[model samples]
Target: MLLAIILVTLIVLIMLRVPVAFSILGTGFLGLVLLGGLGHALPILETAPATAVRNSSLSAISLFMLMAQFMLMSGLLDSLFDAARSLVGRIPGGTGVASVGAGTAFAAVSGSSTAAAATLAQTSTKRMLSEGYQQTVASGLVASVGTLAAMIPPSIILVFYAITAEASVGDVLVAGFFPGLLIAIAMVATMYVGMAFQKGAVPAGQRSTWAEKWKSLWHASPLLFIFVAVVGSIFLGIATPTEAAALGALVALILVVARGRFTTQKFLVAVAETVKSTAMILAIVMAAHVLGHFLTETRTAPKLVQAIEDSAMPALLVMVLIAAFYVLLGFFMDQVAIIALTVPIVLPVVEELGYDAVWFGIFMILLAEVGMITPPMGLNVFVVSKSSGIPAVVVFRGAFPYVVVMLLMAMVFLLWPGLVMWVPNLMG
Candidate 1:
């Protein structure tokens, strides 16, 4: 009965358009008071705000965000996009392929899927259209690739998941690489196949000279270096996640200064934006802690676990049902909010089923990413529409194939968890 009230009140608040952090915070605070009186709620309310933000692991988010901002200020994304185009642009629907490459590269730095979608929509969509690619194909590819921002390393979502799951941040971040790479492969192949079978999907263009490819690759090498240094350092035990982030940010800062792109305005903007983004994430973390406390005290997740056990359902079937529920939530909520709300409840059940928390972290993130391009909210789709003036419906059609690809990949990941854990295992 108490769990029902907690769930219902949270739903009502979310439906009323309350901010997620506020909604979760209010629901938990009120639940605590109701469940154990003001005596219990007051101390948590006072302490959670401080403890949540004080997490040492969270510093990595600020640094990685700052690194992305600095890289943006220096215009590195354009270099990476141009380089990808030079290498891949001759293939059928090649510009669309390059957009995915650019999107994933950008994702390596900027963890926000919406930011990746908007940037690529502005930068790549026009080129894909000018290159005689189908509008649906061009727009859909950009929107779809944005979700990669959540899957790639240095992803903010990974950090959030680490905090919530009480898992190793480095392990979870490392685990994303293979799955992210596989998804990228599938997305790119979908483009190649879609263009090849369908006449007039993409008009053939001149192949790039070897010289042009080399030049573009050379110009983009530093961006590649940053990605390697950050992830490699963490993988090789040379730096902790926070230290890797600092190193990445420092390199980005130095690069901008050397390139004469550093400006007081851009620097200030980066810092200010980092502060804002960090604060917002911290709020969600704090609220989630409060909510987690309420759930734990009420023994809600344990009860749910026991109920499932009592029903004697197969673990596989139970996991599939949980996956479906998460996807349904994805339609309405972004990954961060969903993680904050659900991880506390779902994680114990997941562990009880003999799954690794690090693997589940990647799994949860990959599922949330699909939501970015799916309908209703489909935040990435709207971002592309707003930036590129592509009709949402057209983008939706474009994204549909990738949606199929993601669903298939989710099943693949579920059946073979080692695909995610292999690198993390080596890193250990």
Candidate 2:
């Protein structure tokens, strides 16, 4: 009863618009006091921030954020989008499809879903809307494609999951490759289908001349190089994710300087943004750790796992319930908070039920992606709205089909876990 009350109170606080970090921290502090007295709780509160900050993996968050900020400031994604448009924009729904491609390409170097959505939304929405595409389709494509960052390699969410779950960061990063590709393909397919049935959902784009296409490609090549350098280093076992992030940030800085786009003010802004984002993420990590410690003291995970095992529920059904629970929770919570709060309680049950942690990470990322584009609290949707000057409801409307695609992808993973595990297996 105490545990239930604690969880319900935390949920209520989140719904009441309390800052997530503070809500989690306060709830955890209260739970710890109730369970183990102030003496036990005080030590954990005092120590969690330091311990979490000590994780070297946490530094990658800042480095990757810097890399992404530099890329955005360099205006390189503009050329990348042009190149993708030149290559595909002549087909029906092509601009929308190009947005997906650009998002995928950008996700290789960007560890953030919001950054991907905002950058692409700013670039794609105007072109698509100008070309007669519907507002929802234009903004929604940007929002849905942004979620590609969540499952793509170099994803910050994957890094956080690895550190929290004590799984191999390398394996978890590699595991995302195929499932990410699967989701991207699904997004494109959803666009194509919408174009078919909705007529003007996406209008055909002007074709680029061969000369223009080559020029666009030339301008985009540098950004592509950064992607190859960062992701290739990881895929080829040349560096850890942290090393690759540093290399990518350095390369981005070099590229910006080479292009004469580097400004001290912009660089400082990037660094400041990196610090701000890193602090927010780490604070959540610290709070979640405190809460997790309290939950563990209550043996909640073990008890939950035992209950599932003793209920005669098939492993597949249990997995479905877990996925569904994540999707529902995602409607109300941010992905990082969802992962931090639930993984501690749910992961052991998943492992006991014979699911691989790496595979489950991919599964959870898919749910996260869905959550990012869902109605009401869809962060990416609102980002797209703000970036494109479109209404949030329009973005959400456009995202509905893509949300179905995500749900279908989740089912595909449930049916064949190997799709999520194959690349990671190749990592050995």
Off by over 4 Å in 2: none
Name the regions of candidate 1 deviating beyond 4 angstroms.
none
Task: Give the CA lDDT, 0 to 100, for residue 217 in model 2.
Answer: 91
Query: What are the per-model numbers of colliding residue pairs?
Result: 0, 0
Candidate 1, residue 159: the lDDT equals 81
Q: What is the C-alpha lDDT of each candidate?
A: 0.87, 0.86
lDDT of 2 by residue, 91-190 (tens): 7777887888888988877878999998898888888888898898888888988988888878888888888888988788878878888889988888
What are the TM-scores, per candidate, against the unseen true structure?
0.97, 0.97
Candidate 1: the clashing residue pairs are: none
